[model samples]
Target: MMYFAPYIDASGLHIPSYTDVRDQLLSDARSIFGQDIYLESDSQDYQWISVVANIVYDSFLTSQAVYNARGPSTAIGSALDIIVKINGIKRLPAAYSTCYVTLTGSVGTIITGGVVADINGYEWTLTTPISIGSSGQATALATCKSPGPITANVGEINKITTPTFGWTAVTNPGTAVTGAYAETDAQLRSRQAISTAQSSQTVLEGVKGAIAAVSGVQRSVVYENDKNVTDANGLPPHSISAVVEGGSDDAIAQAIYNKKGLGCYTNGNVPVQITDLYGVAAVIRFSRPAYVDIDVTINLKQLSGYTTQTTTDIKSAIVAFINSLTIGDSLTLSSLWGAALSANSVPNKPTFSITGVTAARHGQPLGTIDIAIAYNEVTRGNVANIVVNVS
Candidate 1:
């Protein structure tokens, strides 16, 4: 006599299968009506029993889902949204890519609400009311019109869309600070875990947590040098260096100022002035991670079910894995094999066998050796640079 019931034990919630539910319902029917009663598959009584069993199974599934939603790690969608509120954090929305473009034109020419286009045809809106300097040039921050991971490399944004008088040309001198899509559930969950360290007794951990909590901040690493002299990494004594990606400069500076220990010196490339409640101003500094472009070459021997799409997927996967690496994380050539193979979602059968893998810095000769990333540098990979040789 099998009984169908959901139960909670040390292993957590467990629900019986639909087959068990159906069998139990039939058993109950026979116990009430004699065992000799007709309950064939086509019988009205059997159909009614199956209906009740299905409804009970559905209710059990719903109950199980609700139970799992109570924990942040297993929650998803709206459930995850509600759970993260307990940590005083919300999902980071998509952001626009930004770049500094130098406008070369007549001096004192004011361009308000000017627009420019990248070589890829993406439109970027310049900061308003920019007056050309006496050197016949003005540098202004331009934000992409469309949000999310838009990129414009140096010399790419050269088309002036809003053609103001004396505005002869436009171009970005450096790579755009790429934007991001809406934070995924996994990303949010990880951030929530880091945010818990905000109240840590260790000041360094607390400072790191506070910076991680800043809105629009994608990734951050904190390094501290507590000795009486400068350390090997060039950090000043009793100083901290934060290598951060994303977020506004002012917001990151404020977060660091609020949580860092008193008398601690900060070291980095970007500096912002923060005014304390006492009306005293102090300079806080942090580094924006420098990006290193990596080129990869993958040779593959095609297996069953391999297609042109598989090659594309393999390239995309390799690029994604490279870009997801944190600052200062080394790029191991062996790891790329797994990244390339992950493109095959099917179990047991693989789509391709990687014959060889090689990588190098952009414009450098590809090799099998691991690429060393410096403390303030992050590796970036473009699908265009990932060459997949498929047979």
Candidate 2:
């Protein structure tokens, strides 16, 4: 007879079923007390054996969990947190949203420690003091008081919450750079894999890896034009173009300067100067990812157990799927069906059937064709942009 015991082999830890453990316990008891021992479900001896078997089974499960936690791919929660430290990276904490607001006031006016309010009534604290210049306006960076993905659109942050002498008005010229929640296990795992390429044999991969490891960098891509002529993307000959989202301009410039090959040209719209240890300064350029707003429409036929919450869940699922696409990743119409259906949690059957799914760029008519994304553009999705029609 085969014995059910926790064992480690080439396949890693193997755990036996509870039934097998209980049966083995009963078999051992029969041998210990003799073949004719009186033991049944109602007997005290059998009940005691069942309890012991349960304890043993739980111990085996604990052992399996411990074994899996040692590997980065299988670990989760705190275990994964510890494993990632081996790569010299810690989980990124949540960040506060920030935006630039232009302050219009009397020239030569100085304002310190001020606050601006968006239309939503959320106050954004100015990160630095502002002095009205000769042009009668000055711009200051403001950080939201509350953290985690707060956003303020252009012209929405027009209220001056902290009225200071000579500080008359405030308005954001561009949309706020939204903050991020604490990095999830999946995002951290992906980042850890990229960080290993910091010492890659290829120069391009090394440059890409170094940029990705920068603090606050959410997503990044590196493209090279090796030919003697400029490529179709307008990248110069023998140059690299890095499209990055998030992170400070100075930090990003230094990362690129550290890993790029000697005499390699960098391509981007934003330029930042980096000074070396010898006081030698070089200008490095890199692009920030452009956002392409995506609109999705999901039509579903409601089945039993479907409620209004189900529709909300379906819309959220679709929006998440769209937002998860990396820079340059095209939006496929067929993929939305699976993303929509994943919202159904009802057992045995789905709560809804997707009759049709279509997507398009914001303000355009929805269509079944996949939307093409540029190399430096990322898809942005909003829950409001998603419409779920149920019948």
Candidate 3:
């Protein structure tokens, strides 16, 4: 009675439920044997025939399911692992954001490699030893030791701890961005299908596709200066610029090396040079995405419907909404307001404001409190930093 399979319809173009398979077999048996032999009596022979029909119907349903499962768009694609294996694409893994941090201490102080620092208990480790001089500086860039996107916030982790000697302060000048989880099945399928379709030759889009397929790469944009005109950015003519988020520079560079046209150039601030199997070097230039902290404040009046857990739920909703935004994506004030208002415990028309928009810059938060975001930047919001008030 519980059917979970589809069969071809009479039209041949449509697939419909196989719910009547058992009944159809029963009907055929009745028509051929006549009801006088089976339907006229509640006989054991009739029961056996019915049982056999049910078993045959179940087999047909299983066959239908087996047929449907072969398609990538169906639910069984992931279950069977056919989506990746068939297309030669694998799921990207999660990655952490890396950035530079400025460490400050006494004028004569020194900080060594392996020294650990933290913000919100998230650790950033110094990759090299640094000494403080007249400037009271030790190191300028610190890499994140954490392995997830949770430490991707810029300008948030400033406190220095577990220093070598006399190290006083720590700060990140640039936003620590580009942490992301592995691509989902939907995302992988989109990239896999496109790449597979273009398998014959490597093109510009193919280069982008290959980069996107790299594990931990969340998003990417490719720009070309094919005319050889040096644009305002001083990029040489025939150069390509890739702006990407969430992946290792080496992996991205290798992907570019595999797919880009020969003699085409790559340009950017940081360059990763990779050698191919033939020992040819390819240099790919790119910049990691910058993170902008979105600080929101909600004002609400406690009503009969309000519960103690409402604030927590609202904060969670805000964090979830912020996390949903991707690189080069902009969020309007209205959308953010709606996200806060959509919380289960928040009443209608809850008073709110975009208290501020801070660009997690190296030295300070740049820009006014505007809702607009730059193309190379993404947004982040922390529940602990969110301000929620209920009167």
Candidate 4:
């Protein structure tokens, strides 16, 4: 069997660990005996958290659910992973920051900068040679991101010559090579350089968007209270609070409903803020690479409540609160730095599924409630247990 204890505070229900209340309960019992010596307790009463989730049942303040259900955990390790896999799928540059690959000649070949935005991810390797002539083009494995200033010994596709002769190893240099390779034109190389630069810029946009998204989600869950910090103009810290008490279901439920009220055509569901935790499942950060990544997050918090009620009323109020919420209350995702989606690739935004709910206020359950949300990164899955006494 478990023991119960609680204390009240002005403006809200502040429940600490079970240790304090347990000692108090034992002390109260010991006081009955004039020669009070020692009191007894059990191992089950040692921990603060509950074995099973339960709600507080107090008549003074109506019950409103303070529980959330975030089903299974995604096996993602870092913030970077989440952004790349679930947030968006983008096309990266052929190589890191450099749009153009070096054209090394093997004594007689021309380098061709092909116009393509994407290729198989594994197809790119460091220092994959670039070429100028037909034979040089044959060994064209894309040279992806390389370390600091280093020239790739691409063997036969040397620098772009002035008049642009696409020279292939001549049994002779004149007309022995393929028509395309032997008669290279100056215009082609110039045009290719311009196109490559433009493509790299697009890829950057998508990466930046992903980075911004991850940063924001981290802020919402751990950052706690976010006041007028954005545009406070150096004012003192403002207030960010939620008053959940034992108020009646009538005003208590409705107060939260109106504030986070959204898409309420059917059942009453309390509104919750959802952010895209993109960096949780995909990319691994490298100190320096070809392109940069930027992630964005949309934060949400409920600032609503009613003053007079009991524990039970709060539970019903919790259900109605969720129902009144709508979807669009989020930070609009912008295309920052990215390669434009080609004919093959498209963007992947965050997808969430919230499939469960548990409630408790004074120490009893109103019942088990189940909910489904389009996004899962909205609320914390586990909540601390309730500590209640004769309050």
Candidate 5:
């Protein structure tokens, strides 16, 4: 039922729409047999023509999909090797988070693996054995029940439910880091389509493009700390820094490994280290994005006629514009106002004021919201975030 272009190219030789094909066939039948054919009525001849036209129209659509490179042939993205070869980049699977699970027991007591803990009803299982020493406690690496960005929060998992022999208590020592979801079909298609234009060559932009193809990655920026350039972040000469967000440590590391040049230093606060195909070690790091929240107040003097849906649509348009911003982007009042008035079916234009603009770090517990955000922040807004007053 989805609508597609009814023509294949500028010549419009292909008839992709059933309605258009049916109408044309009906017209042609009338011209061939005169008024006796009665093609527009519900005659047996008309029924047969309709069925045949439907089948032909479907064929046109399928042929169009194949010619447009959007057919089922491209859906074989499940094969990782095929995806890498076709898209010129490897798609990463879901990523897991590693954290220390604490266990309390008598001195010298051995805390066994598979001991479970409840973090707000989510389970975390220990993998390595931990021996209680002078501290009468132990910590071992544990993995989340499932992987994804949901486990990336700090201090979100506090409660421990599973009891272990000779252990008094159990809890996760810190927030789970570097969990991520699997790649989706739409996401894969988008990555593949974009890479098709550049061929995924081994260039700076190509490396960044490859990283962007990784699942759970929101945005990435690649930088080269070249010679004669005094690096502010204290990188070795001729090093590369791959700053990324919303990605697991393992996935991001592999993405960098697949694309980075040999002998280049991988810089940043890498949660984990990854070795490239040639056994070259590189530290892949993540830079979390800050979220900026904008509070908009609009006063509309209804001129002529405007529907209530128009007001609702205006709010959605404004919020959509705000959310479209990416990392290292800034927000301005003028841009926000323009977005509000750009909504379709909105019948009125009114003056507005941005009463407040505030931003905060994603996980900052106690921080003031500033009126403006820095370049490394992304904006978040919704219909609920905008207030409209109509008279």
Candidate 6:
């Protein structure tokens, strides 16, 4: 079964499923790994924290009565000693992150306390301070970040119990350095290039394997990481070195997600082809990037059809047919239907036959086209785009 799926509801785009949770975890993983936090394989770390704060006037007066001849009993009533007013009291429930101050105050000082705490959970106490006869300032307490060991990187994704494919280690072939092959700057560049290629191969293979495992979809490659020797012919590095699981290692991955409509994703990497609808099937490709080209092929076939439609006039007929399916077209077609002469019909269809998906640029919203159209196709199906604005 799929781990989770993101679904929308009436409560203002509620991510009413576990996908939000898992995706959040994935986000945390990226946050932890994409930094300099060195991590040892198969190890875990733990930390406990404490935070507290309070507000008071004439704290010096609260000091031990024993300091002066005025014992604890003498503190009770000493001519009302300048008449101090008790400040407001703000109670904290165990430990929560966000807080508000009724009065401007220093959380770092005056108000104070602490308790053992965890990142996701903790204990904290807050204080409220008041003015003392124009001598005191009204204030509240707030917390700040404390620098400590926070960076964490888990093993690479899909690295389950020694998965089949992954990045492989390599050493420069030149004799200059232990792993260095040659002294020339060209050689150094060559060494780095080959190492990079090897790593890309490992990751590409892993991704292909993953897509291959998914049913009803095919995988193909549009481009592969490549390495070329300048001024001479040399065998590229045999092993893959590093593939940017997140970014920076290579051309960042590009993808676009449309939650309001059918989801489409496009990445140079493709999935394994799925041939069986009744039984499990997949599509996959093996590619080597040390060269210019890698062959990729992906296709999703209808094992069974859904509805039936045959029309003499493509527009009216297809519209009627698509109007028959369960979909909304707040989106316009990706392109105006190019009237293909022959009309056709597909029957016994599954819920959605995802023909293809292109991944969004990993980090940047390269572009967006909002389409406001609904689509059903007999000759050519409807497509959507994130245009200037659907409105």
Q: Give the clash count for model 3.
A: 4
Model 2 lDDT per residue over 120-155, tens place: 788999966678999999989999988655557689
Local accuracy of candidate 6 as per-residue lDDT tens digits, 315-341:
333232232222122322222221211
Residues forming the 10-long window of minimal summed lDDT in candidate 3: 353-362
Measured with C-alpha atoms, the lDDT of residue 332 in candidate 4 is 16
Worst 10 residues of 2 by lDDT: 1-10
Question: What tens-digit string does per-residue lDDT give for candidate 3 at 1-391?
Answer: 5433344666432332343554565566778888765542387765766677667667765676676666666535455356566766666666666677777778877566644455566777676667777887755566666654555454766766574667777777766654554556665666666556435554877877777777666667776778857866455799777777766889988887777787888776768888778897766777666666666666666655666677787777777677667666776655655676677543554433334333222234444344665655777766655667776
Candidate 4, residues 63-155, lDDT tens digits: the string is 111210111121122322233333332212122312233333354544344322112111123132234443353333333233211122122
Mark the regions of model 3 whose C-alpha exceeds 4 Å error after superposition.
1-82, 94-148, 152-178, 181-186, 189-202, 225-238, 276-282, 299-305, 345-370
Least lDDT summed over 10 consecutive residues: which range in candidate 4?
175-184
Pitting candidate 3 against candidate 6, the one with the higher lDDT is 3
**Which candidate comes out best when scored by TM-score?**
2
Q: Kindly state the number of residue pairs that clash in model 1.
A: 0
Off by over 4 Å in 5: 1-15, 28-53, 70-83, 86-88, 105-121, 128-136, 161-168, 185-203, 206-219, 224-240, 244-360, 363-391
Give TM per candidate: 0.79, 0.81, 0.58, 0.18, 0.53, 0.14
Candidate 5 similarity to native, TM-score: 0.53
lDDT of 1 by residue, 1-391 (tens): 3564678999889898888999988988899998998999999999999999999999998998999999888888899999999988998888888999999999999999999999878899999999999999999999999876666778989999998998899999999988866888988888888888899999999888898899878878999999999888778899999999988899999999999998999999999999999999999999999888899999989998999999889987887788778788999999999999899979579988989999999899999999999888988876767898887
Off by more than 4 A, model 6: 1-210, 215-222, 228-339, 344-391
Rank list by TM-score: 2, 1, 3, 5, 4, 6
The C-alpha local distance difference test score for the whole of candidate 3 amounts to 0.64
Give the poorly placed runs of model 2, Cα more than 4 Å off.
1-3, 22-56, 101-151, 156-171
Q: Using alpha carbons, what is the TM-score of model 2?
A: 0.81
Please give, for residues 33-115, the per-residue lDDT of candidate 5 as tens digits. 88676665468888998898889888886675455443323544444335455555556567666677666778887766554
